[model samples]
Target: MEASKVIHAIYTDDDVLMSAVKTVKAEKYHIEDVFTPFPVHGLDKAMGLAPTRLAITAFLYGAVGLAVATVMMNYIMIQDWPQDIGGKPSFSFLENMPAFVPIMFELTVFFSAHLMVITFYMRSKIWPFKKAENPDPRTTDDHFLMEIAVHNNEESLTNLLKDTGAVEINIVNKDEDAH
Candidate 1:
C-alpha cells in the first residue's frame, strides 16, 4: 500500500500544545493524534473527543464481582459446608452477610481494577512486546507531538502550525508495512 503523508507538530509545553489544538480545531484541521510526556488536563475536550465510558464498565465489573461474591459465599458457607461460629449455626447467607462485607468490598475493587486495566490495554491496542508508534522519541521526555494528516494543503498547514508556536514541524510518510 502507498504511504500516507502526515505532519508532526512538536511543542515544548503542554499549555502551548493545548492552545495550538484549539487553534487547529477552530480552523477545521483534523488532528489524527497527540503524544504527550504526561497527562494534560482538558486535552481530550479540546481535541473534541467524546467522554470515556470506562467508568460505566468499571461499575458493571463491580456489580459482577458483588454478585459472584454473594453466590460464592452462599454456596461455600451455607450449602457446600456449614460451620458453627460464635454459636451461630444457622446456614443463612443474609445472617452471615455482615461477616462477608470485607470480602465483598475487596473482591469488587479487585475485579474492577484488574478488568479496567485489561480493557484499557485492549482498547488502546497496547499489548506486551508491542513496539511504540511515536514518530519522535523526544515526546517521551519533554515534547508534545500533534499529528495531522497532510491532505494536499501542506503549505497552509505548515504556516498555521508555525503561527501556533510549534517548536519543530516534520513531514512523515507512513507506510503500512512500516508497522
Candidate 2:
C-alpha cells in the first residue's frame, strides 16, 4: 500500500505561513496539507488548488428546483384537481398560471435551499455523525499548520522549516486508510 509521510509545522502568523508556502513552492517541495483557522486570501494560489465548482452545481440545482415546482404545480392545480380559484377561467392552464406562481416560487426556494445544502454536504464528504479528522485541536483555534512530505533531505527540511519560522514541528505517520 502507498503511504504518506507528513511533517506538521505550526506557525504563529499568516504572513510567516504564506512566506513559507511561497518559499517551499520555489524550492519544488510538495506541500500536502495546510489548515488555517480562517481563510487567508491568496492562499489557494500559493498552494495551487483549483477553483471550486460548487457554484455551478448550485445554479443547476436551482434550475432543477424551479422546473420541478412549475411542472408539479401545473399538473396538480391545473390538471389533476382543477378548481375555480379565481373567477378568470377554470379549464385553461395558462389562465390559471398566475395563481400558481406563488406556490411555484415558494417550492423553488424550498427545494433550492434543501437540495443545495444536501448536495454541499455530500460533495464535501460531510455527513451526519461522521467523525472529524482534526489532528490537533489548536489547529482549529489559532495556529496555522503546514504538512509536507519529503522524499529525501530530512535534515535540510528541518532546517528549512525552522527558517520558515515554524514554532513547533512533528513527524506524523499518516494512516493510509481507504475512504
Candidate 3:
C-alpha cells in the first residue's frame, strides 16, 4: 500500500489553532490529530470526537473498591477477630459500619484513582520505556500542531491552513518500512 501523506500545520496560539480546526472541519477535511502545549477547552468537540467514557469506568472502580472494603472489614473485624470496645461486644459489620467509613472512603478513592490511571495508560497505548511518538518537540513547549491527512488536495489545504494563521506548514510522508 502507498504510504499516507499528512500535513502538520503549526500555530503559536491556541485560539488560532481552534479556529483553524473549525475551518478545516467545515471544509470536510479529515483531521488526524492535534497537539497543544496546554489543554484547550472544547477542542475535542471541534474535532468531532466522541465523549470519553472514563467517568463510568471510574464509578465502577469505586463501586468495586467499596464492596472490597466492606467484605475485608467484615471478615477482619467481625468474623476472624471480633473486638469489644466501650463495653460493647457487638460482632456485627452493620453495627460497626460507622468506624469503617474512613476506610471505605480511602479505598474507594485509591481504587478509582489508580485504576483510572492504568486504564488511561492502556487505552492511550503508553507504557514505561516506550519511545515518544511526537512529531515535533516544540509542540510540547509553546507550539500547537494540527495534523490533517492529505488526499491529493495539498495545495488547497496548505492555502486554507495559511489563511487560518499557521506559522509553519510541513508535509510529512510516513515511512513505508516503519509501518
Candidate 4:
C-alpha cells in the first residue's frame, strides 16, 4: 500500500490544543486524529465528532440482563423445583420477585459494565496483544498530538500549526494499514 504524508503537531497544554483544533477546523483542514495523555473535555466536540451511543447500548444490555435474571429465577423457583419457605407455598414468579430484586439489579449492573467495556474496545479497534497505535510516547505522559493529512498544503498547515502554538511539528509518511 502507498504511504500517506501527514503532519503531526505536538502541543504542551490542552487549552492550546483545543484552540488549535478550532483554528485548524476553521482553516478547513481535516484532522486525522488527536492523542492526549488524559481525556480532554470538549475535545470531541471541537473535532466535530458525533455523539456516542454507548449509553443506549448499556441500557439495552441492562434490559437483557434483567430479562435473563427473571427467566432464570422463574425456572429455578417456580418451574423446575418449587420451594416453600417460611411456611408460604408460593410458586408464582411475581410473588417471589421481591427476593429476586437484588439478583436482578446486580446482574443488570454487571452486564452493562462488562458489555460496555467490550464494546468500547471493539469500536476503538483495540485488541489484546495489538501493537500500540500511538505515534509518540510523550502523549501518554503530558503531551498532545494532532495529526493532519498532507495534501499539498504542507507549508500552509505547518505555518498554521506553528501560529496556533504547536511546540513541535513533524511530517511523517504513514502506512494506511498501520492503524
lDDT of each: 0.93, 0.82, 0.91, 0.93
lDDT of 4 by residue, 1-179 (tens): 56889999999999999999999999999999999999999999999999999999999999988988999989988999998999865589888889999999999998988898899999988998978888999999999999999989989999999999999999998985465
Better of 2 and 3 by TM-score: 3
- For model 2, how does the per-residue alpha-carbon lDDT over 1-179 read when each residue is reduced to its tens digit? 55666788899899999999999889888898798999989999999988977777767777887799878877887778877655655577687778778877777777777877888899777998988776677878889999899566677888899999999988776865335
Residue 56 C-alpha lDDT in model 3: 94
* Predicted structure 1, TM vs. truth: 0.93
List residue ranges in candidate 3 displaced over 4 A. Answer: 176-179
Residues 1-179, candidate 1, lDDT per residue (tens digit)?
56799999999999999999999999999999999999999999999999999989999999889888888998999999999988988488888899999999999998988898899899999998988888889989999999999989999999999999999998988775385
Instruction: For candidate 4, give the lDDT of residue 61.
Output: 92
Clashing residue pair totals per candidate (backbone < 3 A)? 0, 0, 0, 0
TM-score of 4: 0.94
* TM-score ranking, high to low: 4, 1, 3, 2
TM-score of each: 0.93, 0.88, 0.91, 0.94
Residue by residue across 63-163, what tens digits does model 3's lDDT show?
99999999999999899999898887649888889999999999999999899989999998899997777789998999999999898999999999999
| Candidate 2: C-alpha lDDT | 0.82
Most lDDT-accurate candidate:
4
Candidate 4 runs further than 4 Å off: 176-179
Task: Output the worst ten-in-a-row residue range by lDDT, candidate 2.
Answer: 170-179
